[model samples]
Target: MKRSNAKIISTTFIILLSIFCFFKSTPVKADSLTAKYSMDIELNGAKKTLAGKENVSVHNSSGADLKELVFHLYPDLYNKRETMPFSYTNTKNVPLTEEEKGDISIEKVLINGEDTKFTEDNEILKINLEKNLKKNDNVNVSIQFSLKIPKGTSRLSYFNDVYSLADWYPVLSIYDLKENRWDETKFYPIGESNYSDVSEYDINIKVPKDFVVVSTGKEKEISSTDNKKVINLTAKNARDFIIMISPYFKCISKEIDGIKVNSYYLSTDDKSLVDIAQSVLDASVNAMKFFSQQFGKYPYDEFDIVESYYEGGAMEYPELIQMPKYVTSIEIQTPSTKRYIDAKPSIIQGAIHELCHQWWYVTVGNNEYKEPFLDESFATFFTAYYFEKCEGQYSPNAVLRSLRYSFSKLAEINPKILNLPCAGSSVDKFGNDKTSYVQAIYVRAPLILEDLRKMVGQDSFLKIMQTYFKEYKFKNSSIEGFLNIIEKQAGSKIRDYIGDEIYSGEYKAENLKPTDEEINQIKHETLKEKIKASEQANGSVLGSLLLRVENGEKAIIVKPSSLTKEEEAFVNSKLKSYFGNSYNKLSIQSDNSVTENELKNSNIVLIGNPWNNKIFSLMANNIPLSINKTRVFAQSFSENSDSVSGIFSAKNPKNDQNIMLAIFWTKDVSTDFYFDTYANPESIMIESQFILSIDNKRIETGKF
Candidate 1:
């Protein structure tokens, strides 16, 4: 019964979230009209601890009667004396706020230095204003607080030998204009998009001369007076800010496009650490050019790559990113003892991914908490695109990371349930990090874009992306808004596809139309060979795909041309059984341009686009990917090698909940890599010509 209820909730989130993105309209400038924020933080640091206070400036862009100003008290979530709250990303300090001895709360509400209306819900504290000011009226809110770090969670600021303090203080919540959905649930340990009114932050920190700090804003001034270092920082209009302080840290710097690039790491990091940081920056700056030229000029002074203790490989903040320096820490026991040692996945990939977030989340902000895919997918696709651009390679072996992940997740979850907002998904699922971050953010997203690229030319496609970024640069967006952009640029079919498949999890997955080169290759190799091999054969393979209305019973899934009439009849009969209703109704184009619905009728769809003579115009340099493979890759109707996907029936169908897909392929040698997820590779694999299936009862496998 609980399982049934869980399914219902998951579907709700998926549907609502999809409804927001699938059918987007024109972009909006949410930040331009709503508000802007800036900050100045002053810190006092020592050996085992550090403390600071911030002053914020805000402009109320909303016309509504404004009363409560919400401050996202992030660190307070960890102070629970019971189960300690923590994530691999941002910091959450325990005992973060000093409880006021006399009155209501630790925070002294000061609007223009006077008390105002304020309230606290869970950990988020909302401040009230004295006057209901009209739109565009500005105000200042100053917060003075001291924070103490728990030894386990301290990676940002530390006191004695090596105390690092991360996620230490209060930052502002990102407000959504389409709807101000204050997703104050909890910080996703992975990372998330944030909002705060734009302001100027002037911070003065007094730390020991031995300590060094890396932060979000520009370093205004640094001076030492009486053995105490005063480091002042001032940040412009950014969503949020973060600071990292440590005594045992070291720095290596480089310049990209004239912007100062700083890399921070522990002294223990190898010498190559500097080069790796530069590579990440070079790749990032190159990626920035791709986006800036396509989207808009990057809206900041500098971007940072700092070595942090954040779990996973890396995490992106507004202007700064925390990167994992070592693949195997001393804790891994022995590296040589282990045969492969996982090749020690470095911080390089992690840095590239996080820096890419600058465009998707930091600069052109989205509601990441609700629809993580908006950022994750954009970045995932960006990751692939950047790899090809910088490394001068194909979309690397990493594309399968998304393929397997989406496929497995699709089976375990119904798209209906998977679409739920991350906040709601947590209750529907277990933890927020469990499904939403993996599925909605990483898995399903890249495929949507990959499919988009396949449908349209890369030149036309990249133009649409640039327009989307330019339009939605500072505003919160709706699904309708996104649909409008695609509709105006791409054809209406694309808009509908986004609405139905990408948005509703009802994607066709029908093989995309191959280029003329690919179609001719099939014609020359298969049909032409058969014609030469047998004098009696008069028809062309094009005729088979363009098989007239008369031949349509359901679909014509022709395999190796050698077949008996009995086998042909058997295949036709099975195809009709699967697509009986559409069999007789379908027809092909005179030019043999197969439509989506026609392909949908087949038991297996083959969308083989040859890389020959085609140019991918993603980068300024005409980099090419030679994707020439001579093999028949086959999988069941639902069994695709690309992604493990699940189609959840919003309303449980009375029919049997059985879905077993068998993909048959004919190739000389199958590549041995990983599957079962977009990232994790321990699920299951059926070797060349082998079978793979998924159902609630059992996973059946057999070769045809």
Candidate 2:
């Protein structure tokens, strides 16, 4: 999943952290009892329903007799809002319509071609066998069902003419040998809840000819007619099967190391949108290459990345992933007014993270509801590792710094979080607070892995992971099993070191807390990097005041005392829109009420000319541009025309570490266009100096 929130620590010490090691190998797997599923499903697009019949062949590997077969009816959870795992608040508080409600109806069930007694409740289906089966027995269970596709964004949902079908079928539950029972954990909305054994799938899907189908395995077009089409898909040793259908799907493909990778995106005429899709494609290819070399060879011949509507971050399936459409929809206007070529870093990071699941969750399976950190943490750690080795736009140190910062801030809010066990706790333990859930599983869990790497050295850590992958390929592993692997490779001391941290969740929070000096240094370096990169690439400054404020720096907006209350409210509203949640940290004061301490320590945005704004008057000499009652002075020229306005930033006179951004006009300028243009981080160009006319036309803009 893409991290919705942000993380801590020192620079010189962190740079010494060992880099992850990469390895290459041939494909390998461990033999185990498995299930083979054959399904024929047809989609009724007009009614938003799927009618299907499924036959599952299961081999008993529990070393004991079985009396019944259990399956998870995941789609039934969506039958009503009350049964759904997720909160309606997360869905923008929009109630689901009757047509939007989803449900799965089991019309008939059979065991070995004979009628069987069955019960369905709480999203679980249990079929009682006619007689107790012996050890190592095989059973064929057939189910006929129909499904209603919900209208929304989720793992199994339909929205905007696209259908995302995952866990849309009744899947046989895993039999836990230790407990002598089937794994029947209920679906939890906070984290991944679908848990099943690796199975072989032979699926036949029938859809409208206009609908393009993307699914888990190798797909072959079977037949096509004027209005109907049939496709056959076969997947071997896959943990789960998923399908996506859309008539507006556009595709791009690349082959890496004999593995064909395809990226399916929504059809769009906008060239920029296509470029964003291409970016995701490129990131997926790079991540696959990096993870395959580092952990183990990718066993599959094909991988699919589908861009669709998902409420949260991207989700990982067996051979396919769901990439959020929001990534392609996002556009940032650069100083040159050209759309930024790079998509949001979250999209790139999300692509890499989800692909990592192919190695961890897909091939080497784990019970996600029981131990989500096993896959999520490992995926996140490898994401940082990819940046560290690939040397892309973001570096490992940058990633580490961000993580550390987030941890420290969260720790400040609730010190007890420092003692919470992320590795040992199950997903349900975190409850409904997604923030705390992410903080523990996604944020702190990876830091624990990094700490382990530092303790065992990079080479030993590499050997441990490689051995874990090789041993657990096509098998499910527990926390104990992973610890044994670490102990084998890194010895007892190293195992104990990580074991204590994982079980106790007691981390050295003080060590991770970054010092104020380090924070300031990073702030300055980031500002410099942004300016240098933007200038070198497009000759425009890309840094914005909003960025600084978002970094947790104190900010104050100083307006002229003569300004009307309505004008102040307008400025505040614009700032709120620009800053979003970060706006609450900002303060607004009249020039008469502004204090000297604020000028020295806080980032100041002066909203009036020197003549009317006292704080601007005090700092006029230090700024790059000069603004007075009659004219605005630039570095090379001066404008005396009425309505001439200037916006510039410079070091605060009282404190060089702070910044002072000033927006002043020679006369009464049109506040509508001026504030609407300059106050917005997306519209304003980042330069030390900028001059504009009352009509919102650019007069002069440059950096000092």
Candidate 3:
């Protein structure tokens, strides 16, 4: 009887488990906004024209009924010279030529298989729906349009037999719940203007059979029929799509952790440049791996980096990246900065920059119109992060070094930007000055992120970034979204810190010296002076003299001196930064090797003091001030000069067109007086670590 009871109990338990399994197997619905697009396009490369037919399926997730649909016609903004956002002829920015202009025309629009009325404005396309679509309803719209690709270098253009297509379709705009309408932000030239919803795409492109296509989304298939190549692609949960096509493309690819990375470059005979491009591709693969560990996994199965003709260094899209062909050209040269040399992988810093965008922008989407910094700032920060952590370019103290450089320069050039918060300022805050806007978004914003890291600690900060990526992936995020998640992770209100670093418009700048405007004014005046002095001079060879001191065993002697390795490296870096591409123009020589004729006709740069090189002794009395082994005494100029390390500049006695900059030190001080203040004839005395003494009357102080 006891055995029979045990069997019945076991059967009852099994029946209960079966009931739980049935309910658990039921599917749960996922809540998200959905828009599906199907497109067919024909490329006419010879005429630089594109004809496309699109069918869009839209779902009304907004609670209220929608009577109209809004779209962005981006191609219209690039057609005319008056409406064009930017030009790339030179720094002064030349206007587009006739052949370089572009335009777009809508042939027809259909809603629910019926004719629909639509109006086109500058980058704005609004369609009136005949029927009022209720909430949770679906509607289909068909658009037939044609685009004239311009012969220019921009996001969308055809240049050097390369065609780049960005925002080429009539994409639906996001619904602003608070505004109760679609976002109507117009196109702006300085940054990206399109704000879109995550959508699915099915694209079919037909081009000449010889053309090679590199584009966003997964390649499904390619077939050749009737001397034309037909390519099909599909993408899900993407904010934008871009494509590049060229008949001369030479393709190479590699896979990293299941993610395929393809690099497409124009076929070239220069093996050196080709090797450089390959190395850049390799760097990008490493960037992807580093970003995935820092933030989160990169969701896409493949990433593409294509070399094309664009004015900018590079531009990033969902899964595709466009870079200027010059980056891989044989003529391309890198800046001789310490950061560039130590981190050799950053030779393709542009590629690393765009790869980071794949995670920050494509994966964790943001409204580029409302918050440009959200994408640009993070991309820049990670670029530096790639240098410091991934590429091993930066030393442990490099962050502090970069911070000092960025802050000092920003404070000097435009103190106003220091007042604006990185997270709170709008693109319009910079007004027409694109330089300040770039500095604020790229440089200042990254420093703000670094400050946050310091406040919350490294582990906590990593957790915050990962959490943000997980929560906002495939969705649009705002500054509020970021701060909220960060605060939750830190277990405290960061309002004060956020306000001080990102929102507040107040700053203290007493610690910094030599404003950028002051420095620039001096540079301009000096260049002008050089021009005036050269009006009747023999030739345009305004040269420079380099001198160094090497203490010998027996006695101090004058001889031709070659720089040590460390000295050569530092001088090269400084020369490149100070003179840019024109560094080679400066003539270099030793103190003893310099001819008397050369001294009379060229600018002189003395590396050591009068006590060591003896050349400065000839110009000593002519200088406004003098210093001894113990103290700084003045002949005609006066200021506090105790513990001074003398770096003086004066007019050459023989030629007014020439000048002399003496980097000197007294016997008592060991502080290496290294600075880029050669533009002014003023003497800079470093009394202490950060103290600077500038005699007003000596440099004609107010003139700058």
Candidate 4:
């Protein structure tokens, strides 16, 4: 790997820029809890490593004489072991080579200026005290370590001049008086890997002059020598501190409601992505304000959203969020690749979701290893609310559609997950199955939240969030504690939703009911089907519509176009054979050429994603099924690059008398091969069972 001239120049320019951007530091409040950390680190960019020193002071607030202190060395979980938390994989989805594996060498540890012996087990560092420290006594511990950075998708890794430093430092574990020990939870790669007390931090980082730093706190100072830049940052009452460094980044800053919001991205030689990130930052700012009013006022003075590489789309830190670079790297005008790259929606969703964590997980801290739903559930639901209510941008119909799709996916993957409680399940219960954990914590938990909202009412639900936030801000919250608050707010609560469903792992949606609209839709469809059957029996012409699309775009029929020899044979022979002259006349039309009159009179068929068909794109949510052009996602399955093929039916928007059948396929599928599954009887049977629901409230999806 070689450095470019532009990289060198950018480094120099950033060091110079930091000097002008530094702000004066503010003194810490005297009466606050006295856990504080001061650190200095130098990034070995060329070696993909970090050499650091840390000093942490913690008061023994557990009310018991402390014999030892515990810290979670998260980055060291990358060691080659059977139970290691992470499996380093490359873009090609293969495990990394030995040299790329991450490891941390603890060079020295000192307690009150004396060298101390420490024990390491399963990525945890436990230091013994020579004598028991009395309750309320404070201890200062110092550490020196070298971290070998891995090159892969990681929460803390370096690749291609970009460094994602999350949980890279040794963090003190929370002390649980009830357990009479520190809460030293093992690392679970699927969900949160670290849990710690909210503490103050003063960190000074020295990186190569050009490497721009995006971190968790307010910048206090910046200085530069010839080749290195030193930056000082401070975070007050934050659960964790993170630092992201990249020389390729272009940074933007804005002030929103007294908080400084910063957005950083890798320059793509195009400003479109940067513009998108700016808009996302704005949306996040608005979300933060909405959450503040609805929950509690955010305690932080600054927030940063930085583009980084990770296994997940984005990760939430205290004041810093690592937004997956995939969101900003998308080609705007025309999507370069289909699936997971839809810039606008994904960016907004990620931005709001992560910012919501600033309140739920950061402020109202929770034991993520014990009760992930406390954070993930609220973050997800708030993301929905931001889109549906707070922002007033996404239509209610769209929100419902997306949620219903998620529910269906959960049902498809494992209906048992819907029955299992999300609240009390241990992080280890999810194991390394990221997909199931997400469906349980992110998807199903939100649905449960919505159920509670519907049961209590909107006003009460909003207050519940506010009460919970205010009650537990800057403290550890539990499922039991949250339940007590919401129950008190509701007044007439019996079976606790969180306790019964999430914690006990025995939650079944109770008394599922279909809405009035759903019942009417079913009735309307039944009557329409009777009329169509009667007309067919009386030898009347049965009008039908057939739409053919190519790739995900609408293909026009300006002139007679051709498909492959196999495609022509399937369409003319096999496809016609399956229908067996069911339609009196099949009206064939292109996505670009479909007429309203045809939609009004005939049974219509659409054969592509909404991206290609204007009609489908506009009415997708209005119809029985919804689609995002970038990806076809289901609970059990998701195909990136828009490669999934499915046949679905929904009522034609132009006319109740007409029927529209959509046959969608990915670009890679052969014309003849795409519809092969639709021809299967099992596929049809599964499609027929379209009793859709929202928040476990069943809805009658109209027949196509």
Top model number, lDDT: 2
Q: What local lDDT does model 2 show for residue 588?
A: 86
Each candidate's clash count: 68, 8, 3, 12
TM-scores for the candidates: 0.59, 0.73, 0.67, 0.68
Candidate 3 similarity to native, TM-score: 0.67
- Alpha-carbon runs more than 4 Å astray in model 2: 1-31, 85-95, 327-343, 392-399, 413-416, 509-521, 528-704
In candidate 3, what are the lDDT values of residues 1-704, reduced to their tens digit?
A: 00100011133633453333222222222245557887777787656788777777788876778889988888887766545555454333556666877777887787866678999887878899888977888877777778888888888888777889998889998878788888777776666676787888888887777677788888754677655777897888889888788888897899999999988877888886688668878888887888888898889888998888787668899998887774322222335311111222334777888888887788888888668767888887767766767434222223433443556666777778676645557776666567776767776666767767767888988898899999999888988888888778885466356545566555333333335664564344444333323222322212222211111111111222644565555545544543443445556777667677777766665554455555656656765446554555555444454345544434565565555544444533232434442443222111111122232112212100
lDDT of 4 by residue, 327-407 (tens): 443442323312122356667777788888998889998888888888888788778877778534223222343454446
Residue 160 accuracy (lDDT) in model 2? 76
lDDT of each: 0.47, 0.74, 0.65, 0.64
Better of 1 and 4 by TM-score: 4
What's model 2's overall lDDT? 0.74
lDDT of 1: 0.47
- lDDT minimum window of 10 residues, candidate 3: 547-556
**Residue 143 deviation, candidate 4, in Å?**
1.0
**What are the per-residue Cα lDDT tens digits for candidate 1 across 1-704?**
00000011134643443333223212223344333332223333321333333455555666554656776765554454322333443333433333211011234445655556667656577776777644666666655444555444333333233433444556666544456544465544444524444444455665565567677777644787554566776676555667776665676666555566677666664655555555666656666666666667777777776765544446777678877544432232333321122222334556667777777777666555555666667777777666656554322324433343334346456745345333212222335344444654465546667677667778868877888878976555545666688888997998777656555543323353334664444333333222222211221111122222223334323232333465445434533532334455643221134433433444222211222111111110311111123321223333323322111101001111211111122221112211221121111111111223232222332222
For 587-609, candidate 2 gives per-residue lDDT tens digits of 98888988888777888778878
User: What local lDDT score does residue 310 receive in model 2, on the 0 to 100 scale?
Assistant: 81
Q: Best to worst by TM-score, what's the order?
A: 2, 4, 3, 1
Once superposed on the true structure, which residue ranges of model 1 sit more than 4 Å away at CA?
1-51, 81-105, 153-168, 174-193, 197-200, 272-275, 278-282, 328-338, 341-346, 391-436, 506-704
What is the RMSD of candidate 3?
Answer: 17.6
